[model samples]
Target: MSKETETMKHNAEVAQFRFALIAPVIQGLFPDASATAYYKRVSAAPLMLPEGTSVKYSYKTLENGNPCTAPEGLIH
Candidate 1:
């Protein structure tokens, strides 16, 4: 791919990854909201993290036998 094309591809991947990260949270928080409204609400909410900390998501099995991704954090 050309340099510009490569950059666009990477940007699209990043956007999709970010959406995946937030999708479950948005759905849980706004179960009855439309997609457009959910996006609006989530975008307007404040996401605060402590200094030297990062968020990470991990997939694990729940007691009910369903797999889920839970967000965790690492603090430096």
Candidate 2:
């Protein structure tokens, strides 16, 4: 693939990964305080990627990237 194509594909994958990581919290089943705690707990652990490597997003990053938290954006 071309460099641009590769970068786009990687970005798409990362977005999907981020969505999956925050899916539970965005479902609106939890109270606001619970959601905050959930993010902290999730950020405290490593996430397993599709390729099997683990990575973790910090609480701020995850919360900032969450679709529901954003003022405007397509949620998934």
* Candidate number achieving the greatest lDDT relative to the actual structure: 2
Candidate 2: residue 46 lDDT (0-100) = 83
RMSD of each: 14.3, 4.4
The residue pairs that clash in candidate 2, if any, are none
lDDT of 1 by residue, 1-76 (tens): 8999988887676555455535554447545355444444444544323332353333211111112333432110
Residue-pair clashes per prediction, in order, are 0, 0
Give me the displacement of residue 54 in model 1, in angstroms.
11
What are the TM-scores, per candidate, against the unseen true structure? 0.37, 0.61
Q: After superposing candidate 2 on the true structure, give the runs of residues whose Cα lies further than 4 Å from its correct spot.
A: 29-33, 48-56, 71-76
Give the C-alpha lDDT of model 2: 0.73
| lDDT by residue (tens digit), candidate 2, 2-60 | 99998888778877877876788878765447777877987788888755788876777
Angstrom error at residue 15, model 2: 0.7
Distance from true position, residue 66, model 2, in Å?
A: 1.5
lDDT of each: 0.42, 0.73
